[model samples]
Target: MNPGKRYLFAGLTVLLAGCTQPAADSPPSGIEAVYTDFFKEADTDRSGTLEAGEIGASIDRDFAGLDLTHDGVVTIDDIYSKEQAEPPGSTRNPDLSSHLPYDTDSDGRLTAAEHRAHLLKLIGEMDIDGDGLISFTEYRVTRRF
Candidate 1:
């Protein structure tokens, strides 16, 4: 992917994850707090952790918005097709990405498990403090590796 597309895809991925991070100087919030907030929305069973079934249930509702062709799966081609159909000079940022969002298996097809795993991967990377917690700065500067 080109730099522009890569940047766009990264932003879309973050938006889709639905994370909330305060500024670097703001009061820190525990990873559990953020995780709870995130999982609460996706964990339909209130099981404290998200399951593939719950993730799929949520995705099923959202998939309709992305599956423009109603193929039951979204691909990069589908994204580009939507891009072309948009009006010229359109400033709209699509929720889809060519980086193959949430495709943990890298089959180029997104599954609910893949989506959940991707979020877990990102959460794993957020605890930069190494103190069993994430500082506000760590969450704000999530790119720290």
Candidate 2:
């Protein structure tokens, strides 16, 4: 092989190899790591992809937490109530940004169906491949609140 052609081929090979993704067994970093943790928690069946049921189950638990009043629906008052109950200088105050928009019915209340809609929207965004499955990488690009 000619010297120049050999060098070009070597460079191309290295570039293509670099483009390959890291092994799934490899530990993740930064946002990918965070999403990895969430994916593991949400992938209850260990199917590798997050399905609607898994997401629903997880979101349902979260919805229960948000509904502090136990009235079966979440309202702005409930959110603010939690925020006001926080200790002074508490950075862990409730963030309404994560809740208000989920009220799809716009009746000033958030229900389980509404909450599921928002999460399903997230999953739609995460399904970049349009395979009806959300992978950890796709989930990494999307996060509520």
Candidate 3:
């Protein structure tokens, strides 16, 4: 082989080898992957932490939809009513099961405070080191499985 051709082939081989290696920050499969992917998409500011405002729009929309009586609050009744009204397996219906866990006061309703607390708790879990920030490494290590 010509000297120039040999050098070009070697360069190409090196590039291919580098491409095959996994990224240092690549998230693993399962739960970690889900959180990592969500964090990446939700961190609109790219500040690494998913702040309240970053998710405020989604939260507001969901809350509004679930607060059937326009009482500025969501109760189990509202969820139950919505569930009953919707046909089985309807995609339009929101899964109310997740909200049940956030009823810390046990008043049978989910207030804004409870909603905020639930979100904060999730953020705390993701920030395993309690550094008030969730880096990719923290997210990876915090996976339950």
Candidate 4:
């Protein structure tokens, strides 16, 4: 190979190597390392998505914490009201936008169907190859995580 070509190849190799190195705080390399415990905890029925019954316990706790009026249900109104009520820089405030995707009907309420659909959608996005399964490389490349 020509000397110029060799130098160019070496430069490109060094740059690529630096780019591939994981950050210090990066999660371990593999879907299992990152999601095994979470999947086990959330996938109560062993189904990929967390269904209504499976989500009840965790959702109930989150709902109770966010229900400012102590109402039995959590509505979009409650989230907005809480956001407006919280002072700037308050860590107590929740990012209500995260819940919007689950309100599929846009009725301002999160139903089990919506929740399940949302989770399935996330899984679909993570399955980059459309193989119905997420690999470590797919998870790492997924920007949503």
In terms of TM-score, the best-performing candidate is 2
Residue-wise lDDT of candidate 2 within 74-124, one digit each (tens)? 887788776647667856434444658767666778887888788777678
Model 3 C-alpha lDDT per residue in residues 67-112, reported as the tens digit of each score? 8888877876687777657566765424344647787767677887
Off by over 4 Å in 3: 1-34, 49-70, 81-99
18-71 per-residue lDDT for model 1 (tens digits): 876556566435764564454457666665444456655655655666667777
TM-score versus the correct structure, for each prediction: 0.36, 0.61, 0.50, 0.43
What CA RMSD would you report for each candidate? 15.5, 6.0, 8.8, 6.9
Off by over 4 Å in 2: 1-34, 84-99, 143-145
Which of the predicted structures, 2 or 4, would earn the higher TM-score when compared with the native? 2
Pairs of residues clashing in candidate 1: none
Question: How many angstroms is residue 21 displaced in model 3 relative to the true structure, after the best TM-score fit?
Answer: 10
| Whole-model lDDT, model 3 | 0.69
Q: What's the lDDT for residue 25 in model 4?
A: 75
Query: Please, what is the whole-model Cα lDDT of each candidate in the order they appear?
Result: 0.60, 0.78, 0.69, 0.60
Ranked by lDDT, top first? 2, 3, 4, 1
Q: List the residue pairs that clash in candidate 4.
A: none
Q: Which ten residues in a row have the lowest lDDT in candidate 1?
A: 131-140
